[model samples]
Target: MSSTSSTVLRAEHIWLDGKLMKWDEGNVHVMTHALHYGLGVFEGIRAYKTHDGRLAVFRLREHIRRLLDSAHIIMLQIPYSEDELVEATVDLLRKQKQQFANGAYLRPVAFMGDGAMGLGAVNPTRVGITAWDWGAYLGDKGIKEGIRAKVSSFTRNHVNVNMVRGKITGQYVNSILAKREAVLAGYDEAILLDISGFVAEASGENIFLVNKKGVIKTPPLSSPVLDGITRDTVLKLLRDAGHTTIEEVTVTRDALYIANEVFFTGTAAEITPVREVDNRQIGDGKPGPISKYVQDTYFRVVRGQEARYADWLTYV
Candidate 1:
């Protein structure tokens, strides 16, 4: 496999359940309850190489807290404690430190294992953690030149149908459909709207709009959007830096077209600018100044250069 491929497929060990096992042994039966019913919750976390040459994960505890929240939302009980999972994640990162020198993406998933079938399927929860090197999710070029996004036909799931607060495994099927549609339509990513027609978020990232007045606006948590950890970090950072960040804003599709700037936030996408949406150019068709500021600041904080946020990092 190419060195830069996301799927390395060769890891020393995988933290499964409560023990580390060979990557080849990280197996699940075809009839696993989660596999059949999609009763799993997962988190995407990243560890970065600090300026001082140490490796640390950003917002590690916060991510774990969210993971637990996701699990609670689905009534799945993880077999391990948060402290144990955090320790396992740090240990896993240390074990793969050599291959993931460029930094790594950690996927920690908790799901229902093999057990009862049908509507009454009840099973013990299984947890697994995998670490691998990952570069910018939207590609370096997409980060620099900005990405093209299409408003998807797929509507965000109704809160009554799917709990928007939890990162349920099956909930991503909608994202998959929307993303595939956008990619096939020749766009970089897809933007989903709420059932009521107001703007929601991108396929795998949270959306942000910068109005001409220079205020930053994003869809509220009530808008059926995932409460993205990265989104929270950015808002906190902006507020700390004396910038106005607004939430619970109802942004229409046409509002995006005339916005001064637009961007997406998530652990994977970070802070990527949206240069155009539906062929409407955004602010000279480039990464806007505010977007650049947030991106640079985020990188610095993640890399341990910003001491004010140093407590956010967990060293491996």
Candidate 2:
């Protein structure tokens, strides 16, 4: 749970209102509306070092679009345009990667820095950008053994009441709680369903299911899943490989038990396999072939190896 050290960490980087500070140095009002009432949005973007010692980020354009979309859902006006945000990320990573000479992680947030107690004040919009080393969020299982998850007793919130399309701060209270419950229950993570019991996502990651017939399936938008950048990458890779992709509403507490392969995808989770759900072993309880392929293709694409997906990265 400790953070990366300053010896390998870059303290100053670009952010608006425009000043660079240590990653842990900052002051936001404790009564900030986003903290009290969940009125802000954010994105997690990662920069990976290629085998060539150069660094790149996956899907720079798409992540910025989703960040802006999430901010719009809450009416938070970002001070920067999508292109500006991309440039900021590239710049910050370039600075950190130069000193650290390795991959770094970025957290770019758009939030209401100020809001009235009655929730009726003009939101003061701000962006806080930070970058440092991110060793791993899910560790080696991210591609090796894969992760094992549980069906959370908790369910994802309805989009009608809470915006599920973007990374909203308050919505993560739900994710944090569910993931905590699963960890205590002896699993690596939690998989939540839509209010209707349709498979939605695993805490912060998007879930994918593989059927016995070698078919790839995932819970589509009807299930209120986030349009994850990594999830889309795997989907596109599967399609380009001539595999049929089923992005429809799917629900089966039983399906997790039978899924020939199951995995989760996100900037944090990357491509993680799920070997079990609620103690039921998935496909002999191991990372399966489909999840492995997705991991291999995604890894190459992200690290600047595959030219076909070059448009997805922003080299720093």
Candidate 3:
């Protein structure tokens, strides 16, 4: 990932509703239902500049589908179809080609517009897509040298209280608080546990651990964890790379402390290795060999260096 700060780099235009508009012109009213009630769904996607000098989005369709699925789960109807949203994303990226020459992070959000203010109000659903230049989410140093994390006092949302399947905007409050708690406590990130006290995930990423015998384990989706796209990709990559002892099961805090390696996987964090948890050193306090391999392969596949996963990329 780029070493630059992860600030949003302004672009020429943004896709709003059904058309491209000036970035600054794309605005939402303060009275928007989603703004007040948190009735919105969104997705995070990345476009990469390939080794051959082509620009492509990683798993574009999958991300879009997930966005739509999230909306459906929240009962927020998006006005556009899947194909329409996909084209709009490609169009927005094409228009911002010069500004995001290095690649960009794409955010597609669907929310309720200004209308009835009641909690059960049925409002017009509005959609927007924005692309901007962003760098390593956990910082470049943390990615390379590994990071310190704390098991958050905050528990992951219960599946009954919050729709775990949906990436709803309001649902992130839990993550924000946990992340803030960790950062304020002098840690690099936060790891949330399920209500049952099993390891769930990081603030915004999925968690994985490698045991002493080379067995890899992660909390099952049955836990209050998001079905992360990067988590799936890493699992496939690791298996193909001959690390076949992967399992999806409940994990404890002690399990992470005693693991040979621990790492985070997500669209933003990518494959960030966890070197310490609760101040306990992890595997020599460095990015482990397996974590490095996964990170290296993930970057290669995203940058179009690997041809086997070519189908996963959508050229812009």
Candidate 4:
């Protein structure tokens, strides 16, 4: 079977509500409130294979906490507790044999269920957790050789327009539209601008720029970007490696064309270098030295090679 098809077939079961069942058995009604109104919250998490031949979930508690926070922001009352969800994730990972062998992606979602039909209709919330072996969010080639991006014409949603802090299901429509635009325009990804034309982020990843001074800079949380867990990990790793990391730095679109190197961070994207933006080559048109350093360090940390960050891993 093709690799993509094989990956899709790998997950035989999923954790629904509080029980493990056949993947096909997990279903939702057609009139699900969240489906109609986009009133749901979710989290994207990954488990990794450590160098010592052990399976571990990176930053499990933090991801679970964020999931709870997102649900709270959207007024979706998750029936299960944080500890319950964490245990469910571990249990689900343990049940999936492929995950134990090669790591996997875990998705935990809680949304309003089918009940009332209006905008103000109150309904019970439903939860589900599923996982499957998956590869890089951007193509693997992009990870090794770097990717090309364009400044998207679409502006990111202002904070007032949506709760930027929450991973609301509906908020991703903006990203979807921008990603489609980038793909149609022959770019690997899109760099969205905040309402004010300041650098925000890629469709699903956080953007970072490294200048000649060897300093790392990314948009502040106040910008129209998700406060990514991987973004936090990268900044911490950079500073721990003796590089200065700056946040909330306003980066103009023109600044990207002149950056020594540009990269993106997220649970899926990891650390992907941007070789070009809007036809402008960053530095020498290769992954910058600082980008490589951070990417290398991040890979090691996630794989349990970095002893100092061992606490970040939760073994299965």
- What's the number of clashes in each of the models? 0, 2, 0, 0
Give a tens-digit lDDT track for model 4, residues 1-316: 1111233534788988889999989999999999999999988898999999888999999998998999999889999998999999988888875645678888899999999998999899999998876787787888887899999999999989978889889889998888888878888898999989999999989999987776668999988789899999988887787765565587889889888999999897888999999999998988878888888998898899999999999888
Q: What is the TM-score (0 to 1) of candidate 1?
A: 0.96
Write one digit per residue (lDDT tens) for candidate 2, span 205-309. Answer: 888888888778888875678888888888889999888656555767787788898888889778889888888888977888888888888888888888888
| Alpha carbon lDDT of each predicted model | 0.89, 0.78, 0.91, 0.87
What candidate 3 gets wrong by more than 4 Å, as runs, is 1-6
Q: Select the stronger candidate by lDDT from 1 and 3.
A: 3
lDDT score, residue 132, model 2? 65
Candidate 1, superposed: residue stretches over 4 Å from native: 1-10, 245-247
Superposition error at 100 for model 4 (Å): 4.3
Tell me the tens digit of each residue's lDDT in model 1 across 164-217: 999889999999899888888888889999989999899999999898888789
* RMSD in order of candidates: 2.1, 2.6, 1.9, 2.2
Candidate 2 vs candidate 3, TM-score winner: 3
Rank by lDDT, descending? 3, 1, 4, 2
* RMSD score of candidate 1 (Å): 2.1
lDDT tens digits by residue: candidate 3, 1-316: 1222245777889999999999999999999998888999999999999999889999999999999999999888898999999999999988878777689999999999998899989999999999887778888898999999999999998999979888999999999899888888888899999899999999899999998998999999899999999999999999898887999999999999999999999998888999999999987899999999999999999999999999999998
Maximum-lDDT candidate: 3
Error of 4 at 230 (Å): 0.4
Q: Please report the TM-score between candidate 4 and the true structure.
A: 0.96
lDDT of the structure predicted as candidate 2: 0.78
Q: Which sections of candidate 2 miss by over 4 Å? A: 1-14, 245-247
Among all windows of 10 consecutive residues in model 4, the one with the lowest summed lDDT is 1-10
